[model samples]
Each structure stands twice: as structure tokens, then as C-alpha cells.
Target: MERRTISVTGMSCNGCEQNVESALQNIEGVTRVEADRGGDTVEIVTEDDVADDDIEAAIENAGYDVAT
Candidate 1:
């Protein structure tokens, strides 16, 4: 599995965190997702190679920003 730590912005509460987590978890290759509101980041584990753009798009679609 490959692990990636993606910086996320615009998350204000636990609900936002959960939304981000759900978005990441829904991606095809994603095996695990950990959204941290305090840290403003999401850690993901996936079997298939995930594109950075795909990750950013997923977060953006969920109404958040991905810090490059």
C-alpha cells in the first residue's frame, strides 16, 4: 500500500472532517482515509496508484480545498 498525506483546507469541524474522509474513502483505489481537522490534512492508504489531481478534485467536490 502507498500512503499519502494531503493537506486540506476549509474544514471547520468534525463533520467537515468526516466529509473529507468519506470523499477520500470513496475513491476507487483508496483503502484507508484519516481526516484530521486539527492538522488540516488527510492521510490516505491505497492499493492503486492515486493521482494528486484526483485527490484534489475529490476534496474540492466535497466543498474543501487541497493544499498543494
Candidate 2:
């Protein structure tokens, strides 16, 4: 699997972590997702190739902002 660490914003609590995780996990090609509100970061594990835009969109869709 391929791992990616992404920076994000607007996450203040654990619930926000779950939301971001759920959103990213729903994306195609993604196998695992871990989000941390403390550092505003997300770590994703994917089985297939995943686009950066797709990941960013998933985070945004979950009411968070991915750092550009």
C-alpha cells in the first residue's frame, strides 16, 4: 500500500478526526485512513493509485480544509 500524509485545518476535536477519516475512507483506492485533530494531519493508506485532488476533495467534503 501507498501511504500519504496530508495537512489539514478546521479540525478541533476527536469527532472531527472521525469525520475526516470516514470521508477519506470512502474514497476509491483508499484502504485505510487515520486523522489527528491535534496536528491537523491525515495519514492515508491506499491499495491503488489515488489522486491528490480526490483526497483533498474528500477532506473538504467532510467540512475540513486541506492545506494547499
Candidate 3:
């Protein structure tokens, strides 16, 4: 598995974290997702073929912004 930690913004509470986690988990290659609202970050574990644009899009679609 490949792991990536992405800085994210607009997560303010536990529910926000859950939203981010759930969104990322829906990706086919993703095996794990951990969102920390306090740190404004989301850590994900996924298959090697997963694309970074897909991850950023998932976060954006979930109403958050992935730090550039």
C-alpha cells in the first residue's frame, strides 16, 4: 500500500473529519483514510495506481479544499 498525507482546509469538527474520511474511502483503490480536523490533514492508504488528482477532487467534492 502507498500512503499519503494531504493538508486540507475547512474541516472544523468530528463530522467534518468523518465526511472527509468517507469521501476518500469511496475511492476504489483506497484502503484506509484518517482525517484530523485539528491538524487540517487527511492521511490515506491506497493502491499504487491511485492518482493524486483523484484524491484532491474527492476532497473538493466533499466540500473541503486540499492544500496546494
User: What are the lDDT scores of the predictions, listed in order?
Assistant: 0.90, 0.90, 0.95
Query: TM-score of the candidate numbered 3?
Result: 0.97
Tens digits of per-residue lDDT, candidate 3, 1-68, equal: 99999999999999999999999999999999999999999999999999999999999999999998
User: What TM-score does candidate 1 get on C-alpha atoms?
Assistant: 0.92
Q: TM-scores of the models, in the given order?
A: 0.92, 0.92, 0.97
Clashing pairs in 3: none
Better of 2 and 3 by TM-score: 3
Model 1: residue 38 alpha-carbon error in angstroms:
0.4
In the predicted model 1, the residue pairs found to clash are none
Q: Flag the better candidate by lDDT, 1 or 3.
A: 3
* Cα RMSD for predicted model 1: 0.9
| TM-score of structure candidate 2 | 0.92
Candidate 2 Cα outliers beyond 4 Å, as residue runs: none
